[model samples]
Target: MSSAYNHARPPAGAASLPAPDDPVAARLQESARRMAGIAVFSGVVNVLMLSGSLYMLQVYDRVIPSRNVATLIGLSLMVLCAYLLQGYFDALRSRMLCRVATLFDAGLQEHIHTALATLPLRGAKPMLMQQPLRDLDQIRAFMSGMGPTAFLDMPWIPIFLIALFLFHPLIGFTALAGTVAIIAMTLLSERLSRGAAKTAMDLSAQRQVLADTTQRNAEVIRALGMLDRFTARWSRANERYLRENIRASDVSANLGSGAKVLRYVLQSGMLGLGAWLVVADKASGGVMIASSIMMGRALAPVEVALGTWKQLVAARQGIKRLREICKATAPPAAPPVELPRPSRELSVQNLSVVAPGMERPIVSNVSFALSAGMGLALLGASASGKTSLSKALVGIWQAASGVVRLDGGALDQWRNADLGRYIGYLPQDVALFDGTVAENICRFDETATSDAILKAARVAGVHDMILRLPDGYATRIGAGGMSLSAGQRQRVGLARAVFGDPFLVVLDEPNANLDTEGEQALTRAIQALRAAGSIVIVISHRPSALAALDMALVLYEGKAIAFGRRDEVFARVSNASRQIAERQAAAAPAVARRAAAFEGAAS
Candidate 1:
């Protein structure tokens, strides 16, 4: 579980890849364009405000000669222009910002979903994906508060300052100084935000752990009457999250306050200096007023830029992660040569698999051949490489040294999509989505319509169960299909694997949750597949189940301890059944006690 959230650092230099076409970058770009337009409009609005005030002052001073009709008309037009410019820019910025936010949310959700689908199988890793989703929510909240000004207007701050300098070097230089100070303040805020980001990530992982713990031990917690204890644990997690948030906010608030104060002071000081210049006739009154207004306008973007400072950090992380995913090595590409069409006969020679990191081979010097209409059973204890062997055979896990030949060509010569189309797989842990019963039964393949779905369900012997539900095939299954009992879920999963009429099918621990009737249905289905000349492979430890298999292999400590016809393997392990039964008898009381305890807790 700890390893799952340990944020595996990309190998050295892998993090330097260019940003991909992610939603965040798209939002930033759109925001940039909108901010550019708004900045121009804002500049025009500021110019009008400055011009209007100066015109009224000129009239009072008799420079333009006070005129009731002309002056009122000119002022009315100026007021209208200012209102129009300000309103237009404000509305434009609001709409653009909303669009950016929506894009951000959509992209984040899509990336999370894609990552879940693409992540490699890592045994026993408690999933940390839920944390990223939570962080994205926080990011959305922060983005909404800052508005388009934070990111979009940022690039314009320097340009506006330069424009002010062109208007008057003195005003521009002073604004530049203020800009530097604002940047320093933002840097401080950013440093403080680092702590917040780390804390937020940690809290998110911790929250997941707590949630899983509560779920896994729900029965225990309830039986022990420890709901209050669990609640306290959750309350503590929330408090820590709150404290970290407050610390981040305190830093940001101080930085904002300081920037605002410094801007005001700089403007006031500029005014005082401009006043001296005006009295000395070195600068005109209009220029002075214009400089004062422009001074503040120049600083406006700087402050907004500072406010969006945290986003830069988050964006960098997001892009780096996106790059890592894009650059992930996919399963080796298929060879240019085409493979023979899949046939009933499958064979492997000198097979050896050494997974990416580990030193030793998981399965070595293994060889076997299965003919059409034949079924083989694999019996092994957990961690004995039985699953790995199955994966290697299906090309999910590559063999380091060997040939996996289906029909008469190398497995690598066959396209993955084509192979998948002809092969059906049922992993030990059945994964179902939050969809209707029919959808799950069809495995979300649109081609499997009502008739096809019902047919598959009938074959798996779960059709009657579906009819028992109020909504029948349309009944909504909760996440992971928790709504269905274990046996029912397994049957549904089996129905899915067998739905597409594949040439070959693989079932991993298919009988794990099946009752006597369910087991019989599976046996009958396997026999039917054999009759259709389709090969079937089953992985399990039940001796009773081996009677249906044409051949069997017994594995121990990652080695094939025995292999042959069912009679031959049984002759070698005739005592194996008695040994298994005795072991179960010894463990029964403890399991029964735990079950009782769990039920009591839940009640």
Candidate 2:
């Protein structure tokens, strides 16, 4: 990470504050002692780096003048051993850093995935859906690259500077001045490019988001002949991002060239000063050459740091972003007390659901309950919150001000993993994964029995349909996998939802893409689930799929207009609709008469 950036580290003495409860933050901070050990390794390696210059000095001063071949050979062997040890320790330190990055990634992958998967259900949008994953990638790259090495070597730079001082006061001061110049250049580059870099990253993320949106709706766009519009949009975003990226690159390039040119000039200047010293008999010729080499060594890490500042800054930003996500979306410190698999009842009490990032409830003050073997159908207009209520019922979306309960226990009382086993949900859109039909139906449960898969298919009445496929239940079906019709996907999703005969089965528009036969099968599945004592909650506009449900809830806007047994609720809805139509019919004559009178008066 960038040595210059905050990287989510608190201010001085913040380390003494009780450690953050975020497990991800804890995992990252817990590695401090190990990092110190790596720093220690850097110290040894940096000290050993002086071996070559010292060897050159000895060769020029002692071996050359005295013709001592044995002394030269001894010094060469000692320097070689130091070089070998230096390589060993440096490699060891880098390897250690790589492992830390790997461990950090492994610990957070699942949490990142969970957060990504739930964002839509929460009606939320982060800067980018895949950013955390990308952040992890940057961490891995930074760990394996020269970024960490630069930071580790930074602390030992004083060693080289002190050596330069020991050579002579003037030589030491010259090297220090060169180091300051490099630092000044780095600060200037960062100051100039920082805003551009940030803008470029933001614009790039927006481009990715647009690309994902367009890809998902490519068929719609092509069919509606809106491809040109989307292309224009993409071009605009790409152009903006490209411009900022070029700006940032130019700043970095200019500063990098300056640093390199300065380094060579500094080395040459050091040689000139050393020669003057030798001529004055203040230092030897050996001192001149060796001091030049030492000057280069002293500035190696600073140059490396300057060259890689961009990467370090990106990594540092990634760390801060990931830490924020981990903190905001962290799961509870302890898993909830695991409740037994829910059965017998599904309950909603004064339920209200407001989607994340929104002020008002999408569905409000609706209450209902169902006992084992009962079925309820939610009826609503397209935008009347049926889907929101369905999501809340299945625990996909949390209620704004009420509780969804299973078997008298609030849904939050049980661990999500434990609770999920007893809950089955088929959403309006059925997205199958890349797997065999049977595997998808069984939710990819590795230990799922074949008999269980067949049972769910048979219950969903898709058994015969699956057998008609080229490979029957073994057929590989998904996007870019084996092709399945919309009805086939819906049926398969139904089978998946009911697999293992979950206690509460929630289906939102299960028949939305179904044909007559598919709808018939869906009706049979709902009946079967009810007969098997499962509490079935269905939200649908189609009447055929509600053939077996005994209760109904009708919604208009966000409020329930009718709720009762199937017949009573339907009759109430029908009567209310009729009354509204009749009122409008009677008001039509008055509205027309009033309009005509106003027009006549104006004329």
Candidate 3:
């Protein structure tokens, strides 16, 4: 079991966030470029099809000679063919645009995941503003339709505008005037939408807060019978989200309606002016037909252009939020200097840690070292910096001053993944996922085999207990080990810590909640690790548990007052313990008499 604990590694190919240099941006740009190319093609095809339809209409007026059967049939057939081709072109362009949109969504998600993983603990709260999963569906829906539609408008607008000018100079002037008016209206819409997007983003973050609260306090809410309070919070969150969504929708509708009105005004004006000229014999039937078709074609792109305004506003906000996170400095990368592959040697020099937002340091200037095949015990009262020091050794918490080196390399120099490979920790409170015993043991090590898992379970002294379960090692544990006894959870946590055969092991109060038999089992597991040339450091208040350690450090307040072999440290602190015990004993009788009087009156 010790062998398995000390040697397992997570399976290769486990999913992780993409690196900083991942090709997401390049991929997004490429997809946009491809969609743009397709748009250009479709625009050219639409222009040709429209021109062909106009030519057929002219033939019916001038060359068909009052519905001559054969000529009329031929012209109708040509118009039908043009209509079919236009439909095909529109479908193809739509598909290509949708593909670009999907690529953008994928890239954005990839970048978000990577950024979240790199942020230090201090930056966790602010970073949540960018990637809340609650906004994911709305963002994706907006992207898929708006992304391609926005890009398609770019090509068609220019082509239609130039074609309108070529048809008649006056009509061209009227279209340009309408374009100016639409631009002004769109700018107003943009301002409105931007404000709405910001509000929506804020509301989305608030919704996440409610989700986290509900999840973290699920047990407390049920235990304390606070269902009404939880329900009230949830209702408030729902109302806020709905209100923001309504505002965004209202803004979008206003923008669309305003732009449509401008397009209709321009279309009507052009058609009216063209009809006056045709009646005054200043325009031909063909010229009027061409002018009307040009206006219809031109109006389509303008309407699409105006609708893209809201999309631009929302995407702008998303991109801005993403940039803020990506540009924030990440944790310093591990240095290149290689430490000797870790061995069962742990050392600390003048180690001191001032926890973030704390006044006095939790751990003071302290120094200690342990070699292979040895064990050290930390003995202290409650809140004596035991867990703080243990955390520093495993690189979970960085020290404010001094260094912790495994083998010979500084802890900070090791990669995050490689650091876990060298040291293991079993915290005082064990946290487990909802999985089988084997699954929990292999949580950090997905590739561990059955033999490796059993080996860890046996060494941690949980092998026999697991085998009695219906599924043995596969027995499913409830969340946070709710299904297991406290001692069982501790054993499983220890088994996981040892699973990779880590060179250094740190346990915080391993015997805290364990019964007498359970403590004995844990003691044996520590002994086995020490005998196998592994260094084991344990924090405990139990004297019997401390007796197995080769060395001991006695702490008072936050300082290590004495350190030596187990017997030597105990000898140094023996008088102090006796003095405190005698003082407590002298007060015990009076306290007991008061308690007895109170009990008698209650009876």
Candidate topping lDDT: 2
TM-score for model 2?
A: 0.92
For 530-598, candidate 2 gives per-residue lDDT tens digits of: 999999989887789898899998888988888889999988888988999999999999999999999
TM-score of each: 0.77, 0.92, 0.81
Worst 10 residues of 2 by lDDT: 1-10
Per-model CA lDDT versus the true structure: 0.70, 0.84, 0.72
Please write out the lDDT profile of model 1 over residues 1-603, one tens digit for every residue. Answer: 223113222346743343354544554565456456656644544454445444444444444444566766776677677767766766665654555455456544545554555454422134344444554655555555553455445555665576556646776787788778877877787777766755655675677778888997798999999999899998998788777767666666677788889989988877776677679877666556656666676677668755655555564454555444433423344456656558668897878877644668888877888888888888777888888788888877778888888886667787776687677788888888899999987778787778888877877777887899879999998888889999888988888877767677888988899889889888877877777777888998664455578888777776788888877887777777788889999999999999999999999
CA lDDT, candidate 1, residue 195: 65
Q: What local lDDT does model 1 show for residue 47?
A: 50
lDDT score, candidate 3? 0.72
Give the residue spans of candidate 3 off by over 4 A: 1-86, 97-114, 117-120, 126-142, 284-293, 299-302, 305-311, 327-340, 354-366, 379-384, 444-446, 476-486, 541-547, 554-562, 570-603
- Residue 588 local lDDT, model 3: 100
Q: List the residue pairs that clash in candidate 2.
A: none
RMSD of every prediction: 9.7, 5.2, 7.2
Which stretches of candidate 2 lie above 4 Å from their native place? Answer: 1-20, 68-85, 333-336, 480-482
